[model samples]
Target chain A: MSDEKKLAIIATKGTLDWGYPPFILASTAAALGYETQVFFTFYGLQLVRKKLDLKVSPLGNPGMPMPMGMDKWFPVLGTALPGMESVMSSMMKKKMRDKGVASLQELRDLCFEAEVKMIACQMTVDLFDFNPADFVDGLEFGGAATFFEFAGESDICLFI
Target chain B: MAAFDQELDATGLNCPLPILRAKKTLSGMEAGQVLRIVATDPGSVKDFEAFSKQTGNELLESGEEAGKFVFLLKKA
Candidate 1:
């Protein structure tokens, strides 16, 4: 085998908060000259969609801090309010922008430019009845065995 | 004010972006050419060091000026 390192990641979440780690790590790995592949399974397949509609939900996320001193006094009840998720999602997006953290689309674009392999799980697509045309161009569709072929030889394998 | 063949301004970008930019820029440069980069992300200080070690690029200088992190990298 070649001496170049390999990185394999299985992306299993679709939430905006959870969507970042896989792309960030994969892009950085590609930047470092590692052969990188990301397998998007289940809800994670949303990341490869042509139009991204990711959102973060504050409900049941105790670690998420509420704005305006609400975290200390408001408890989890406030999260139950209608449209709370959209509110939290917008706030998180603003924070990321202010901190200069790359948006999910930007990170994905970097990965694409760096030639990182992005594979979407075919099983999940069939289960969800998703149209293959809904995803971005240059994506590969495969099953678990296909991912295992690369992951088995990877120096670093992550499930995120 | 170090002499460099190229310069990359990664200001207002955070983790991974600055490094990614540097990597892309360096790939197109000739070997032995020097690249100077300025970034606002505080985390780049450590990230660049690790990047240099991993990629075999030489990190000639790493310092901060006016709160922005500066780096000089010599392509390997």
Candidate 2:
């Protein structure tokens, strides 16, 4: 085995909030000189699409803090109103911008530039009726075996 | 302050942007060349330390100036 450290991550969530961790960690690992690979499966495939449109929903997510002092007094019913998901998503995006957090697209570009391998699960693509052309270029398509080829030998493995 | 071959201003970027940009800068630099970075993110202090250790780069100088964190890193 090569002496270089390797990191493998499985991404399964497509929500805007859940999207950050995999890209952030993988890009950082690659910057650290680790051989990194991120396997996008299930809902995670949404992240690799060329037209990224991930959204966050406050519904059933009690931990999500509402703005305007709503965190302490807001009822769960507030999350069920029409267009609540878009509102929450916009608020989250604004918060990230205010904090100078990198955008998802920027992070993905960094990962690509760093040569971090990105694999899209082929089974999911078929199941979800997604075309390979829909995703960003340079993304590899594979299944469980393909992921294990790299992940099995990796020094660190994470399912995010 | 130590002499540096290049300087990067990362004042408003947060989390991994500063580090990612540093890595990109270091890649284009010759070995042993120093890169001076100025960042405003408080978390970057610890992040740079870890980055130096993990990437085998040298942290020549680490300190604060006028509410910003300054770091000098020597490419390995």
- Candidate 2 regions exceeding 4 Å error are none
Quote the positional error of residue A153 for candidate 1 in Å.
0.7
Judged by DockQ cut-offs, the docking class of candidate 1 is: high
DockQ of 1: 0.91
Full-model lDDT for every candidate: 0.94, 0.94
Each model's RMSD to truth, in Å? 1.1, 1.1
Candidate 1, residues B1-76: lDDT per residue as tens digits? 7799999999999998999999999999999999999999889999999999999999999999998899999999
- What would the per-residue lDDT of candidate 1 be over residues A4-45, giving only the tens digit for each residue? 999999999999989999999999999999999999999999
Interface DockQ per candidate: 0.91, 0.92
Write candidate 2's Cα lDDT for A18-61 as tens digits: 99999999999999989999999999999999999999998898
Model 1 spans > 4 angstroms off: none
Question: What CAPRI grade goes to candidate 2?
Answer: high
